[model samples]
Target: MTTTAPTATAHRSGRRFETARQVADAVLFEGYVLYPYRASAAKNRMRWQFGVLVPPAWAPAQGEHSLQRTEVLMEPRGAATLSLELRFLHAQRRTVQEAHADGTFTDTPALHLPDRVLVPWDEGTEERVELRVAVPELTEKEIVLPFNRPAREDTEPVLDDHGRTVGRLVRRTEEAEGVVRLHAEELEGPYRVLKLTAVVENTSPWTPDGPGTAREEALPRSLVAAHLLLGLTPGSFLSMTDPPEWARSAVAGCANLHTWPVLAGEDGRADVVLSSPIILEDHPAIAPESAGAMYDATEIDEILALRTAALTDEEKREARGTDPRAAAVVDLAETLPPEVLERLHGAVRSLRAGTGAAAAPQEPAPEALFTPDTPWWDPAGSAPAQPTPDRVLVDGTPVGPGSRVTLRPGLRRTDAQDLFLQGRTARVEEVLHDVDGGVHLAVTVEGDPGADIRREQGRFLYFQPDEVTATEEP
Candidate 1:
């Protein structure tokens, strides 16, 4: 069998495989809610997806209804903030990258994916998030991700960012506050050879790939953002009747976690079931408060206020900083949340005894396009079909989208004097076109219920079919 080589970008250097060789079944799972599939919708909008069980017994229609969800119990230390997002998408197995980087290599990058999936916001609502803290212990929990994999080739048991060879995720599990525990880890990356028996347990809260929730208030400024967002119930158990044995000293994410957690327990061991690798990015942060029965709206605002107060010094200097509506994260004392700081205070000192803050500010990931940060309705209208010059004859009839025609956001070429009020969030949804079917500009000063009535959503903000910076939050 003749094998091929991969390009520089794909290789990332470690592998020497061909693109075609790497080609396999890719199962993409995306979650959405009740909102338009526009570009700027939020993540959790109450939408329904197919395949998921939405028994007609549950709904009147033949389609699957909105996914089911539950408010998982969370317990954090002092001044903790929590934001729970419905799992957007989760998958059990996927035809993924081979065990080795390529035929020449023996192991991979030690990457592991979660069995459960969770995608919160959509691509509409100018939704923004922030993590802020002022008190001694400010813990902002983000998202929960769970992953497990069969072992393949191991290394010299190389060390990773979080330390140790096995990549592990440290989270909170105890009912009592101020406890940060290591829930799970990617001691196993992907496998080159599975027992053909490894199984990834998958569960519910599956939303759809359609519309998401609406009307999001981009988090306010002065908020400190914490990234850790996984919750684990302490004392959980992992029982394996006849689990496969470890290949080598397999490790990638955290060195502490194990597929078969315990070997001496009568039943098995304690472990957490997760959909994906829990992430601490892009969740909301509010005023300081203790964990309560429900998320108090008043408390939400109070956090917003504290965040604002904290940003007082920086606000006047930056645009987003000054934007009262924008959100900002404070970078004070400990890089990790305060609780993690205190609890792990002793443990972390040892973890950092040999290292510096290099891990704190890791390389910034490539900015992801097609996210909520992008424009909701970015159009392919830049180089529109140029019409027949002016009042000339197109087979002698008087055609074209119209001369000096204003094609507002939602207002199509329906006729004259009719405004299409379909512009969702920011203003200037459409545009005005010239007689030759060419757009000239769009409506800018609209939408806000303030001193700009005539300047409706998509009325005056016009451009030469190129300036589509409509309704942008940032």
Candidate 2:
């Protein structure tokens, strides 16, 4: 797409990708999270959730809510219709009771559980729910779908193994979906920036008003996955997943990524990158300098195959006993050759092993955006020297220095400066404790330490306790 806007002033165009292809390539890139980003991580693997957005009620006490807004600079092709396709997983609450062979009570059923354990609750269903698209930059804004549902009653008895009478699980729900539209006139400026906001409300109906203490007033909600697609005039959208060339030229200037309307190029092409609302920053779970980080994990496929080379009949049965989601991985590990697992141990070493403290800082690779001191899984790369209170936990992990983190889109500091673009990873440098005992963190780019400094402080960038998460490893 070409723009007639004058390039009289040479500025960084926030534009990183000219098409959606570029955005997809970067977001779905390898190691974007880690080698085993999606693995069960039950035994010895990494499980990453870089782009997860949960409802406020379900979110950790110190974590951000599901509300999200992204600012993007778009040159609409003459009042084009912008379509957005959102995908997410819906979570429903279920009262769970322990089962016994005698079919007796194993204590009162629990209302809420901390972690998302699939065994107890119903299988999560992926949802493409719609919401009213509100843009403060536009002329008109309103909710496309309003909450409306007739009250009804439904109840299921919570039974025991003996098939006896127990408490009831009652619920009511109403759901609807629609699209919000914006006209060219609603958009402003030759370089129009539309602030898209989506407010997901509790569509589920409240518990039936009746006697008995098994009442559930709250309803179920969904969690949005990180990946989102904004449909614009054929090729009108450009990708801003990475930094512009102009911003990369200066060591200190690169830190300006938190600022927007970055002059992408001389063609008046600019890109505005949005950050994740969730903070993935925290100390590493694994110890720094641990052997797990040093081993050549590239051989993982071969090692897993070798370990499962000879699965015993008994071991195969044990594997099937595990969670179905993780049965395959368990099967491979159980039958893996002991010799192979032992031999592969400690085969990897730190990428910074030989570099001395005073060693000159190395330049980032041409395609690199944020450079860190070590790989994501390495203890040194994730763990903090000084620990802080555990408040915001991502995927059940805390935020700490050396830990890799993901920022929410349109994130801002107290002064309203962009925190960092959403859907990317950054490394924690240090965890700060205020006089009030509030916890914060100082973080830097994954591989680019140069981008770590705060332009305002001339030092590392600091974020709130919930601004980041350790969920997304570097």
Query: Candidates' lDDT values, in order?
Result: 0.24, 0.37
Candidate 1 regions exceeding 4 Å error are 1-273, 276-362, 365-405, 408-474
Could you give candidate 1's per-residue lDDT for residues 175-292 as a string of tens digits?
Answer: 1001111111122334432111111122222222334412121111101111111222222212122223543333111122112211121112222212112111121111122221
Top candidate, metric TM-score: 2
**lDDT at position 261, candidate 2:** 19
RMSD of 1: 26.3
Q: Please give the lDDT score for candidate 2.
A: 0.37
